[model samples]
Target: MSRYFPHPAYAEDQPLARTILITHVGTRAITTGTIIGAGIFGTREALRRLRKAAAPSTVTASRSQLYLRVAGHSTLWTIGIVSLGLAGRMWGREEIEWQDRSWRLMENEAQLQTDDWTYGGMVAGLAATALFKRPVGWVAAVGSVGAGSVAGTLGYLGWRYGLQRREPPISE
Candidate 1:
């Protein structure tokens, strides 16, 4: 039965009818808005903090120490982005699951899993760098985490919805 028109037997069952009312277009709109909103606010806050914490350039005691400092900064950046991404992911998943139970829910769950793996991998990279004391510059280290987030988001969207090459799942 259509969610908009509940089965006659469950005509008065309001919750069941409400459970799957978010259409594909509605889901896409909500997800897109959520991502944009979260990204904007998160980036704003990060930038504000960075500006407030700007330090005067000074020669490092040694190249290794400079590398370690950059690695530490990058680790912190990774943690922040991962935390923000996870928070947004959870919020988006909850919203979708509340209004969808089929393909949308499945896709959201998969996206969340992808985010989890990406974030975890970034943390593991930081750990390895710390352990090995490997030299890495700020841009490469920080940009990598940012790239992971972009990749995860785009990868699934492109795979599932790109080019509209296949039909979307039918909604009941």
Candidate 2:
């Protein structure tokens, strides 16, 4: 019975699993858009305020500082967003968890953990440069998080639905 749907255990539910992955991919795209939107709509004023008191500082600092600060801020923003979704563990708090299965939830939880690790690692790299008064290591951190997701999804779909094309058998 459980095989018919996405079981909440360690297993592949295929279609449903793909749906879940696509949902995340969609969600990430939306979040990236939102972050950019929010920043575009309301960052100048905030930066202005932050810079009013800091000398050798303007609304837009050097590229290196800008990268470190904004990237760091983005990391914090991600953490807050993730925390909001984690309000529900066993009881009921987070709304999204309403439909998420336990294993799926765990997998997502692990994913968040990995993201945090990545963000923190980048922070460390940036911090090291900052300590030496150098620039943020953006070059080393190329590629967005969504890149792998979209690729993985496309590959999964191709493997699942495209690799085994059917054709009529030759006449005997």
Task: Give the alpha carbon lDDT tens digit for every residue of 1-172 in model 2.
Answer: 1123454544433336434434443345423533453464357646756888553444444543554455445544554565455433325534333445433533453344333443444344434554534434443122123223333434444544567453323443
Q: lDDT tens digits, residues 40-149, model 1?
A: 54565578688896533575434334434443454455455655664565454644354344333334445344444445544544444444344556543443343344
lDDT of all predictions, in order shown?
0.43, 0.42
Q: What is the lDDT of residue 48 in candidate 1?
A: 61
Which TM-score value belongs to model 1? 0.27
List TM-score per model, in order: 0.27, 0.31
Say what the RMSD of model 2 is.
11.8
Return the top candidate by TM-score.
2
The list of candidate 2 runs beyond 4 A from truth reads: 1-61, 88-90, 93-102, 105-172
In terms of lDDT, the poorest run of 10 residues in model 1 is 1-10
Candidate 2 least-lDDT 10 residues: 140-149
